[model samples]
Target: MFKISRRKSVNLSIAVALSFIAVVAVIAVLIPFAWENTPYFSKLVNDVVINESQQLGRCVFFVWLYICFAIVEACCVMVFVLLIRVRKGLVFSEISVDCLRYISWLCMLLSLFLFVGEIFHPLMFVMAMAVVFLGLCLRVTKNVIELATSIKQEHDFTI
Candidate 1:
């Protein structure tokens, strides 16, 4: 019977955690670039040119805040994966496949929205990279689901 070894399970968990962290990092870097270059933000700045320093400070603060937020998010995802691995067996499961698919789709949709917003914000390249990353994640999830289902069916037949 085809089975997922413990080592493979640990590796897959690590891979997913790494991917999640990478995605969050991309988003953290992209948002600030988009905000600073956006025409609406610029117009807002022009309206209060006298408070330029404050505005700049606020932007910097927000970027830092988001960086922290991304780190927390990544940590949460990693911890959750680790907990699952430690508690349950490491074999591929429907829940894991669904989580992967959901995250990929949501991130892709979010990236698309951000990219379109970049028309006025002017961070097209960053958003484009995010889109590509999300696309690859979606592909990964699709393959994972297929592989899991195939193996499950084979196991069932043998039993």
Candidate 2:
């Protein structure tokens, strides 16, 4: 395999990554609103029951925590994308690759938490979402690898 330059790979990864950030950000903002406004989601949220007020608070806290985590993960991706867009000459391919993997793992963990923590089966729904997010991350990783290899080959030919 031809060696690929980190810069080109990173640039492509960042471009693709920005879309992920936008999607995650939209979800992060919209989910709460949807839960509040949409009749179906509102019903689900309102229907959840816990033994005590403290437990109810805990449920809300957990939901908030999950959303916060998603926001943070998306922000990390966005920050890297911003860096890639502004900088030149050098590449941060490894960082981009790692971020995709880490974010996917985070989604998996959050899904597991929801699956186990929530009394209702709504956690299953969250888990399904996590699967989709993870799949997107995998696609990104594949694209990055392909871009890296292509860049490396191009640079080698130019040498």
Candidate 3:
């Protein structure tokens, strides 16, 4: 019989979530391009643009969607790496700090992207605010981990 610890289960859950996000991000990136020639997509472009430059609007929309998905995919990869480090008991290591720092930056970038998107759709402001909050929380988590690593090294040297 095999036993799974609570911590391991939590880590596994996080890994699964991150994987799911990555999969969804890939799908999102693909769907826009795949449906670019579809009638529904053309109608959507016409509706959104309400101008004669529907083709240009469609192109811009695809590019923006791809950029968003790329950022999300990058964030998912960073989180997966961080979760792997946690599973390996390397939470206090420099690699973990780097992962956290990068994730924080990604969150900030996502927030900014959403903020700009809000100019076209006001509802995106809520998502932008949420990403900003998540970024701040990740930044604090990174600082705390850095501080703990420093304290651990100091204690080890003293002993």
Candidate 4:
């Protein structure tokens, strides 16, 4: 009969969330370094692309890729905020639903960008599919949160 407290569970989740944010931030910063090692990734930002137009395209591609990373960073922050709401016993609230919706939208937007990036790198297509899946999951979760929030509101009003 051993059960961990809610606060402890939330704390552990927050720690994991923070770790994800840190790891993603580090990887985003080091993305340029990783590009050189992969064949598909090396097309942009390398001497292999000798034309001026190609250099510009590579720069833009990398910038967009960095922006995708930033989107992921934002999602992690949203998850952290949502976990805090759970810790405060506000999981079935409008704010939590809103946070989840924002995350879902961000995931969708990131996936759109990644799909376009498939032209430059094949990995982009794979990442796009994964992000779309994540987005769909988030959307479903947001819908559940919205329903719970409405039911909670109704119960509060009845009381």
Evaluate residue 140 in candidate 1 and report its C-alpha lDDT on the 0 to 100 scale: 84
Candidate 2 local lDDT, residue 13: 72
Stretch of 10 with least lDDT, candidate 1: 43-52
TM-score of each: 0.46, 0.45, 0.82, 0.82
Q: Write the per-residue lDDT of candidate 2 for residues 5-81, one digit (tens) a residue.
A: 77777776777667677776787667656654667654444555653464464467547556656645664664565
Best candidate, lDDT: 4
Clashes of 1: 0
lDDT of 1 by residue, 85-112 (tens): 5457643666566555555655655565
- Candidate 3 residues lying further than 4 Å off, grouped into runs, are 1-4, 33-44, 47-52
lDDT to native, each model:
0.60, 0.59, 0.81, 0.86
lDDT of 3: 0.81
Q: Model 1 residue 36 lDDT?
A: 65
Model 4 lDDT per residue over 1-159, tens place = 888988998999999999999999998888778776776666444443433576577687778878888898999999999999998898998899999999999999999999977766667899899999999999999998899889989999999
